[model samples]
Target: MSFYHNRLLEQDYYPVVRFYYYKEWEGFNMPNHSHEAIEIMYCLSGSCLIEVDGTTHKLKKGQFIFIDGDVPHRLFVEPGKSCRMSNIEFHFEELETVFPSFRHLVSEHEALRMLTESPKSYLLFHDSSDVFQCLNALILELDRKEDESVFTEQLLLGQLFIRMAELAAKQQNDTSEQHVYIQKSIEYMHQNYDRDIRVKDVADAVHLHPGYLHRIFKKAMGTSVNGYLINHRITKAKELLKRTNITITEIPHYIGMNSQQYFSTIFRQQTGSTPKQYRRESRYTDSRTVRSEHFKQQAK
Candidate 1:
């Protein structure tokens, strides 16, 4: 069974980017699945083809493809070639918060506007492009697996997004100066949600009062700060329940909730099922889908 995990920068709701570099020796077949993040896959070597919404795109060495979030896609390599690629996944909604100018660029520029407004399955880039360099560096940093500074990582991420956004804005484009106070609060909320964090704590992180932060977060994200926090925690809990073998009782602790009773109440309210029920239904659905696909492939 294959599942796609959405990785992000620890503690930030905005632009949680995950980087991966994979070398598939006998080639690989990633079954069709959809995710909530835009994915950029770059071929460092070898070759493969990606099928999205029934269209097949040939990706060769020195080329890459940017797939929009929530698009179902699958990848496969031809019989002889091995494949090495860098995969970057991130939420597109974070683009506006992370790069304040991104929305403007999308509105003003025709190519970028089209891409954003009506995203295709993917956009292709060549090795010589500036975006490629930024992606390559980010991948290398992620692969190192060390105690790298978050500031440095954020800078690189900012640079990469800026270049890609700006490049799309015209040719192809800060971290600190652009972030609004509410964005900072959102980041804090994301980072500390698994703790016993409160609105005051989030406000203090950005030097604002609790009430003021509440208003701003509500206006910006259309939910109260606490509401956002609970929603985020519930989302994380759902992911864990669906993807992991952890017991339902342990899930509350994992998500920083105080008790299983509260977790079950909230889970049932939000998802219309208890955690165990949800997990069982989800696993059953996945297995059925997998079996159906297997039969189809065999018939073909």
Candidate 2:
């Protein structure tokens, strides 16, 4: 299952994942080199045009492009064109923790259906300076020679993946006859989560009946609209608890919970701990609560 070419690799420089910058002159044709890992290339400076399976797209500064595993593609830098790109090549396994959809091989011909893009697609228009700074920092962390724990860096990379997915969904003009209605309903629920929202209100936004909206939301969000709303409210409550010393009574009002009792019930069910227990357990007073007298090796 290894995707590496043994002829081009030796023990010294074999990398399952790597991050580096590349720049080259015009008229460069990378005549179909193949590899095992998915290639994510971020154009850092200048521009180029790429061809993937007879489809062409313009690649410019700040756009990140994806080349699925083993899919043949080529890059071209036209006359007077200069390209400097920060590229990360990593195995699909590294992506599993973030995207559960990638747990199985959907086959080379069907990989686009899994990620919901063309075989070789560019998630263009994410040309933000702050975003690139974060990506650059992650690249530096990935390529460090000194061995260190990469858990945090991988987490950041996962977040970037989520953001990229969002951007792509916005740009994709899914003209499918069936999916068009589903997409419209999803957008409505996302935008109106804060106020006293109703299923009818959401359904009207997408021209669907309320009952149909319930079934579709469950399928698409992987949860019902009501379920997602409750989770979103709970998420906001937890963030408030962590950042501020807000009382439990104040939380329900701030986060739009209907009642304190309902909030406590949901919190206990979801978090397995009541609000008071959570706040108490989260705070540390340096062994004030740990009453163990037999401690000879304690802090001197």
Best by lDDT: 1
Q: Which pairs of residues collide in candidate 2? A: none
lDDT of predicted model 1: 0.70
What's the lDDT for all of these models? Answer: 0.70, 0.61
Q: Which stretches of candidate 2 lie over 4 Å from their true place?
A: 1-16, 24-27, 93-131, 173-300
Cα deviation at 49, candidate 1, in Å, is 0.6
After the best TM-score superposition of candidate 1, give how far the Cα of residue 297 lies from its true spot, in angstroms. 61
Which portions of model 1 show Cα errors greater than 4 Å?
1-13, 92-118, 144-149, 166-300
For residues 41-84, write the lDDT of model 1, one tens digit per residue.
Answer: 88877889888867888898877877777788989887777878
